[model samples]
Structure formats: structure tokens, C-alpha cells
Target chain A: MTVIRAALLGFGTVGQGVYEAIKTHQKRLQERLGKKVEIAGVLIRDLRKQRSLPKHILVTDNIEDILAIDDLDIIFEAIVGNEPCYTYLNQAIEKGCHIITANKAMFAQFGTKLLEKAKQHRVQVGFEATTAGGVPIIRTIEQLLQVNKIEKVEAILNGTSNFILSEMRKNKLSFPDALQLAQERGYAEADPTNDIEGIDAFYKLMILSELIYGGQPEWRTVEKQGIRTLTSEKVQLAEQKQKRYKQIASLTKKDGKVLASVKPILVNKAHPLYHVEDVDNAIKLETSLIGTFTLQGPGAGKLPTASAMVEDFIYVLEKDKSIKQQGEVVYS
Target chain B: MTVIRAALLGFGTVGQGVYEAIKTHQKRLQERLGKKVEIAGVLIRDLRKQRSLPKHILVTDNIEDILAIDDLDIIFEAIVGNEPCYTYLNQAIEKGCHIITANKAMFAQFGTKLLEKAKQHRVQVGFEATTAGGVPIIRTIEQLLQVNKIEKVEAILNGTSNFILSEMRKNKLSFPDALQLAQERGYAEADPTNDIEGIDAFYKLMILSELIYGGQPEWRTVEKQGIRTLTSEKVQLAEQKQKRYKQIASLTKKDGKVLASVKPILVNKAHPLYHVEDVDNAIKLETSLIGTFTLQGPGAGKLPTASAMVEDFIYVLEKDKSIKQQGEVVYS
Candidate 1:
């Protein structure tokens, strides 16, 4: 058994959760893998921020402090936005260090180039946490593509919007009231534009498109709509008709072209999406071999999202070791 | 690229689907895997029965014929029941052939022994299809165990029972009427004993337990209940309260001991599992790292079940090559 030293690229909620989960579930993780995993460094934007992180682990603002360290085997990028994340990941990949990123924005925008780079470097890049928190959608897609020709992927990829929509339908609350309630419950960020306006869902869908369908549809090609226009009356009307409104991000391939969109759709009571409510996310894949298969789980949160990152770290470690030994042999 | 010669142990629904999936998706599988996978032989119990099948493939009823084929790299056992499936799988393992099985009965009873045998033989056993059709629950559990501590797993593992319950709730039908309707719809078998009595869910739960927790709980130790005793009145009462009755198989570790059960439980509308309706199956796993993660999909059907078996076949092909090059060593 080899012990892999890991580094955190950001110390926000997800990063902190990763650290905490590693400490809390260390015994179980070790038992399962038959090895010890340790966090060697954390790259925070600010070094003086007061938090309950382990004092012994080094915290630094300089990326090179962590990146230049030869002992670090993998990097977990929980950093939001594109600039630093893209730079750090590219550098990490170039350094022959495996990567597990929770940064959907970077992947959504530059995933193709990054994946190509990783492949060129003969390293593994795990982005399971980027799409659906902890639902294992990436691995699921990888497995499904093996046995099925997936024609379409429809998902409620944004939890904040789903949470608000679910509350509006069940509690009969106005959109504003639901949004406010979501904020109070910490389900929605203060700005909430990314989630409520559907940008977050769009980003996730972009990643899914790349992973499942070979490449992403142009950002401009995706028809985007948010939950802001939805009224309480519309939700009630849908419910009266035994339906529910969901913020759906769907990508379909027709005539060798991929069409992607993020919009609010009315799901009848019979559909599985109708049952997906309140910060919960569900993905349905329509495939030639299996017909339709769906997976639902927490689309976002500190612990769940961190769990995904941890899973990605382990997967990357395992896959990276194999890639190192076998060289870059592309599988069919 | 090594071409893995594979054989089908049974030509049932899943076996046929595996055949068709391989034949139809040949180009795609080859493109992804970079290897040519060919079917060397197919084992069937009877050959006189009229069935749609390819002409060039060799078919035989004798297990000895399959076992004697030294060139066969893998055996996909789609046969149901314990007697022949178990015996053939053991033989295949002993003969250094990787096994991909869709039979849950054999796995539920003898997975540990078979897994140990496969380990000793340095071969792999793929059992992804034995759980929830094409939902990828087994792979998800494998990934979860890689990173997180799975504290509990609660699921509606049997689609036939779920379909019956959903029908009873939606149409206010009696249990018997719903069951009859299910039988008519081909969701329920004629006897429906295994599904309706919670035996099927129990078997699946055992498999999940083994995969996630590394061992199976005692079959008799799991507290069991079924939908057979669920009355329409109880269904109506639960619905009136905005709750749904779901046949849930819940597994948890308490006080360092495994606690498992399968029963019909009332789930509030807020719970993610509450929305899974009809014949669909949903699984919600609570882990220390990720709070609650749920996956839902077509639990059972000819194609979905077949899709799972095919996925396992592809996995065995991919992992076998990787494992052969590198030994079965865990990387941190």
C-alpha cells in the first residue's frame, strides 16, 4: 500500500468539508483502501482567515508552495471561478500530478482542453464532483456509455433552484418567499443569480455534455431559462393538474448534432422528475440499450459535494497509478 | 489491443440483450476500449425453443463445453436460480475465466466465496446487473466505498413491489387488484412471491451490503416485511397525509454491528425517495462524507436488466486488461 499526499487548492466550504471528512472518516477510508491518505497542504486565498482547520497542516497563499512540492501526489481544486482554477489545474497536470476538481465553471468552459492536456500528460482528471455533487453521475455515464448508446441526458442539475421550486409547489409559497426561505436555510447563496438564473445548471450540463456525448454544445447553443419568471400561480396550476415545475437542463443528440438547454419544465405526476424536490437533483439518461435510467441525490452542499471530491481523489489515485505503469493507451 | 474472447452462460433475456448490445454497439465499444471483444460461445439450457439469435455463434447446453473452451476469457452468466448458475460460475472461476453474472440469487448466497475465489484465481467477477437493473448502484457503491464511510443505505430495490405500491396509491386500487394489474403489465411474475414478499429486495440488499461494507449481513438476521400485508386503506391514509408507502430495504451499522431490514415504510413528500413512483426503484445512501445520496432508475425490465449485464461485461473487459498488466494492489 502506498500513501498518497493530497493538497487542497481552496479552503472554502467544500475544502473544509473535505478536510473534516478525511479526519472523521479516516478509519473507514483506510480500512476500505488498505492505505492511509493525508492532507499535506491547503492553498487558501487568505492565510489569516480564522477557521477550525488543522493547525499542523501548512496553509499558504502561494500556489507554488503546494504545487512545487514533490511529495504531493494529487491536488483537489475546490476553488470557484476560472482564472486561478484553470491556471492551477493546468500547472498540476503539466507537473504530472493527478487532479480531482470540484470546479464546474472551469470544466464547463475549458474541460475539453483540460481533458486533452491530462490525456497528453498521461494522468487522470476526475470531475465527478463538478456535475452532481455526490451522485456519481460521471462514473455512471462512463459505465453507461460502455453498454448503451445514450441519446439524451435530462437532469435537474441545480439544487438551489430545485429547492425553491419544490418549496413553492409544496408550501404554495411565492417565488420571492421561497427564495428568501432558501437563503435562510442556507440552500441559496446571497446573490443566488447563478443558481436562480440557471447559469449553475448550465455549467453542470456543459460538463455532462462533454463527458457523455464526446463534447459540449456551444455555450451560445444552449437555450437558457431560469426560475425567476415562474409565479406562484403557475406552480399551483401545475400542481392542480398533478404536475410539478422543475428547472431542467437537458442535452439531446439528434441528427449527429447536440442540443442543450436549461429551462423550467412541467413534469407530470407520473414522471420521476416530478418527485425530485427541494434541493434534490435527478438525472435521466435515455439510451438505446437500457431505455431510460435515472439517478437522484443531493445536487449541492458542503458535505455531499466534498464527498464527491473525496471519491474523485481516491479514483484518481487508483487510475493515475495504473496510467503511470501502462503509459497512455487509449481504451476503445 | 488484446481481443478478449467471451461466452454467454445463458441465453435468457439479459443474455440476448448482451448479445444485441454488443452487436449493435460494437463500433462504439471498440472506439472507447481500443479492443475487439468477440463472443466465442453461448450456453443455453435448451436449443429446441424458437428464439431470435445470430446464426454464426456457437450454442450448447452443456456446462462442460463452456468450461472446456480454454480460449474463453470471460463467461457472462444470465441464468437465474442457484443450482446451475452457481456451479457454472465456480467452474469458470476455477478455469481462470472472468465471470459477469446477472443472477442475484447466486450472488446473495455465495458472493463472498466467489469473490474470494476470483481473488485467488486473479480473475474478476462483475455483478452490476444483479442489483437495480441499469441504475449502476453497484458501481456507485464501489466508488463510495473508495472514499466515504457509508453509514446507511435505504432503498426500494424491487421494481415489481414498487409498481404495485405506486398503482395502489395512485388509483386507490386494492393490493390484489394492483398486483393483478402489475402481472398484466408484465412487471410482476405470475407467482410474484419473491418480489412481493421482500425476498428479492433482501437479496439485493445483501449484495449492496457486501459491495459497500465488504461483507454480507446474515440473511435471516435482516428484519423483513413485504407489501403483501399492505392494505389499500393504509395506502389511502398515507396519501391523505401527503405521504407515500414505499417498500424500503434499509441497511445501517449500529454499535459496530450491521442492522438491515426490508419493509413498507411511509415516506413524507419532502424525502427524495417519496417521489419515486410506479415501477421505478430508488436508493438513498447516507454516508459520513456525503450526507445523503440517492439514485433512481428503471429497476427492472428486459432491456434495463440486460443493459446492466452488458455494462458488467464491458467493465470486466476493461478491468481485466488493467489488472493483468498491473497486480491487484490498492493505491492510496
Candidate 2:
């Protein structure tokens, strides 16, 4: 059997999830790719920490060590931040490695550069896990754009913020109380500033805008607001009027100008995002030909995020196989 | 510019919609495929009838005349019924012309055979318009099945039935009255037997079953019921209980067996298909990896359905281009 050697750039929650999914769904992976997928190495911050990683995979604190693996076909990056993640993936691309990433922060800023580099290197880039977790919004937009022109997009993009808002409205709890409850339920992080301040959704919304309109609005021009200021009384008042407060990321194109924003809005029952509660995410797209369409799924999760990466892995490998079969150079 | 010659196999509402879509979206087609798509011929059922078709394109009542068009790269089939439609497409496939069809009755019965023949002749088949009109459920299922095992699918697949049911509940009208109103509103046909008797939904359900589970249950084993027998009193009673009567097509795979059915189901407010009223359609799928995901869109319309066919046409032509670039014989 042909073994497709791959490496993990950051072995955190998402990295562990990918490792576990690849281990468990090996049979399915083989059936799809006609090859065995093997995790050759893992890049971790602390090699001395007690971990549950299986044997036969090299654990290293240095990325160069992991990238040095022979014939590495794919690199699954689940790292955070902008600097090192960007630099590391750029190097991986230089090594002719296909990338499947779940790092939205790094991707939102450097995605275009990385894609250009990948094209020059004749490699593929898969970032389906970067936005909306398990919702195949990226692929959906790609397919829809082939024939239709997307006019507007309204979406619930962040799970942590949505869960907090849902808890606040449903329980009549204050923002602090809802944040505490979300943390207790593992829906929010210890330092939920990024999610609470709407930065996370802003990055995702920018990603969607770039995908649809081929470019995003100026960063400072995008009006970004969070749910921290929403009071329980206001939420109650909205509920009394048959409305719900949701963190909505909106993008609209009018007369060739694209406007993007992320904020909490009061939506009535008729709004599709009105009923989207807790960790669920939904994207409502108004297109030129098909009118209105919406897709809803888990916005963030271990398995769901991992599923997106694996799907991307299968996609990248299939594309590679076709390119190789055709004996042609790939420029994707 | 390279001209891609195409033919229309039927000239009903869907055929006209396809023609208009092609004519209006010519720029988009050229951008996506890098070839100018030109309709060389259209097969109409009547010759002397007053029609507004363009003079340059060939119009004929005979299928042979349209099939005889030289270098016809694609055929769009929107004919009703099962016999001549199936035979016409079969002959087109034998001529190595790609096909995009919106005929659910013909497709649901002979789709597998047609696809097999197309494969033998090195042609592609696009049937995204066959089920759920503009929903794109077929493409969604195809992508999801790459990794996840879809355990169950519950969908509102028929728009006319849903529209009539929505009218009966909201207006407290009788079944016949609501159906008549649907016809008057152009939501239902004058002879609404297929839409009211659940056969339309049944055929679409079987199409989904074939795509997901590889084959559908024996037609006799499937339990099919439409909204024809639904009473206004029952609908009102359900509405009082915060429920709505929806024509749901359900398919479940458990214990290595697949069961399929189409029935008027009472759905609560929490159900994804509950608020999917009027001409809207929604499908909720329970998968092994991504959990529960739902897609909602227009269930039926000239523009929406034509959008799907155009999307398929673009897909077929792109695949053809890639295959030609690959210098290989296509088996699909």
C-alpha cells in the first residue's frame, strides 16, 4: 500500500483531533484515496509534557525536524497567531507540501500570499476548516460562484459569542453570567476576549468577503462590535417582541462596492438566523439566480473541525492524483 | 473564441428557462468555461404553434433533427414523462454528447441506466435539477458522502404540496380549495395529481436514496402519501399545538438496511422543516462526522431550476475541458 506521509504543525486540541480522526477513519481514508494516510511527525511546544500520543510518530519542538520527514505529502496546521504560523506554512509550501489549515487568524491576513506561493510551487491549499468549522461555506461559495453572483451574505460566524448571546437571552442572565456559564460548559475560552469582542467573527467575515467579492473592504471601514454591551433587559425586551439578539456578520455588494460588518443585531422570527442558538452557525446568502439559500451546522468543535480538515485532505490528495495522472503541472 | 454548440431536447417551461438563462448569463458561461456557448437547436413538441423562439436557432418537432446538429457538445433535457425523453437522452449519450436534465420522472426511472450508458460513451451527466428544483441537495450529498456516512435525511422536497399545505393551515381552506388556489397562483398545475398524490416527492426521494445509499428501496416497499388526503381540521389542530403539516421525504439507513418514504408529517416549531412554508424547501441530514446539518432554498421556480441546470452545464463543460487537457479517455 502507498503510504501518504503527513505532519502536524501544532499539536493542540485541533491537532489532536486530526490525529485521532486519521487514526480512527483510516479505512475510510484508504477507500477514498486508495492510499494509506500516515502521520509521520508532530510539532509541539513542550516535548517534556505528558501526552497521550501514540508510538511510531516523532514528537518534536522544532518545525524543521517535522518538516524534514521524507516525502511529506501534506501539512495540517492548527496553530494560532500570525507570525510563526505564517512563516512555518510558507516554508512548508516551499518544500512542496500541500496545506490544510484551521488557523483563521493567520489565514485571514496571509491567505492570498500563501495561495500565490502555492500556485507558483504547483501545490494545493485547503482552508475549509479556517471558517465556520464544519459548515462547508467555502466549498459552497466556490460552487455557487461558478454560475451565480452572490449579492449579500448574513451569517452567525462565531460559536462562542453566539452561545453567550443565546444563554443571555434564553436565561435572562447578564453578559458576565452568560460568559461564566459558557466557560463552565467549555463553549468559551478562558480568555474569551477574541470571541467576545467579535474579532473572531470579523476575521471569518473577512474571509467570506474575500471569497465572494475577490477582496475585502478596508479593515478600519468594517464596523465591528461585540455582545459585551448587550444588557439582559434589552435582550428580554427583544424577546418580548418575538426577536432574538444574534452576532451577525454581514457583507453586501452594491454598485461594485463591498461593505462588510460584524455586530449583534435584533432579528425577528421571520429572520432565518433568529432561531440559530448556542453553538450552531448559519449563513444566509442572497444570490442573483437562485435567490436566497442558507446552510447551518456546528460552528466550532473538535470532531467537526477535524472533519473539515480530513475532507480537505481527501480533496487535496484527489486533486494531486488527477494532476499526476494527467502528467500536467498544477497551477491552483 | 471557441464556440460550444448545444441543443435543447424539450421546450416547455424548464426548457425556456434554460434557454433564457443561457442567453442572459452568456458572459458568465464564457468566463467560467472560456468558450462561447451557443444554442444550435431546440426540440419542441409543436411546430406551427405561436412561439417567440429566436429565428437563427433550429426549431423542430422531431428529436432526430436536433440530434443531427453537428458538433453538438451538450444536450439539455426538460421533457415530461418517461419514454421518449429517456430514449432521446440515450441516443444523445450514444452520440457522446453530455447531458443536463430536469426531468425527474424520466431520470428517477432511467437515471442509473442513462448514467451507465454515458460512462460507456465517455460523456458526463448533470441531473442537479432533477430533485428539489433549486435545492442543490444532490451536490451536497455527493460532497458529504466523500467521508461521512449520512445516517438519515428528512426533507421537504415538493414545493407545490408544501405550498398547498401552507395555504390550508394559514387560510383554513379545504384541500381542494387550497390546491385550486395553488393552481391559480401558478404554484400547482391544472392536473395536480403528481404533486398532490406524493408521486413527485416519491421520485425525488428515490433519487436522493440512489445517490446516498447507492440504491433505493423497492418501489412497493416505500410508503408514499401526499397532502391530498390531509384535512383542514387536522392541520388546524396541529397548528394549535405549535406544529405544521409538511410533506416530508425521509430516508434512514440503519443496521445495514435503507428505508425510504414520503408522507405528510406533522412537524413541530423546533423541526427544521417546520417553518419551511410556502414554496421553500429544506433538508436536514444526520451524518456520522458533522452531526446535524440543514440546507434550505427555493424548492421550485423557472429561474431557480434553470440556475441549477446552467450550473450543471458549466460543470459538464469544465469537466470536458479538463478531460481534454488530461489526454485521457473518460469513463464517466
True contacts kept of each: 0.74, 0.66
lDDT tens per residue, model 2, A50-135: 88877888999998898799999999999889979999999999999999999998888888899899989888999999999988
DockQ of 1: 0.57
Which candidate tops TM-score? Answer: 2
Each model's DockQ? 0.57, 0.60
lDDT (10s digit) by residue, model 1, range A231-272: 999999988998888899999988888899999998887676
Residue pairs clashing in model 2 are none
lDDT of 1 by residue, B112-203 (tens): 89999999998999988889887888888777777677888889999999989988888999999999999998888888999999999999
Best by DockQ: 2
Model 2, residue A317: distance off in Å is 2.4
Give lDDT: candidate 1, residue A48: 78
Each candidate structure's TM-score, on Cα atoms with residue i matched to residue i, is 0.93, 0.96
Task: Report the number of the highest-lDDT candidate.
Answer: 2
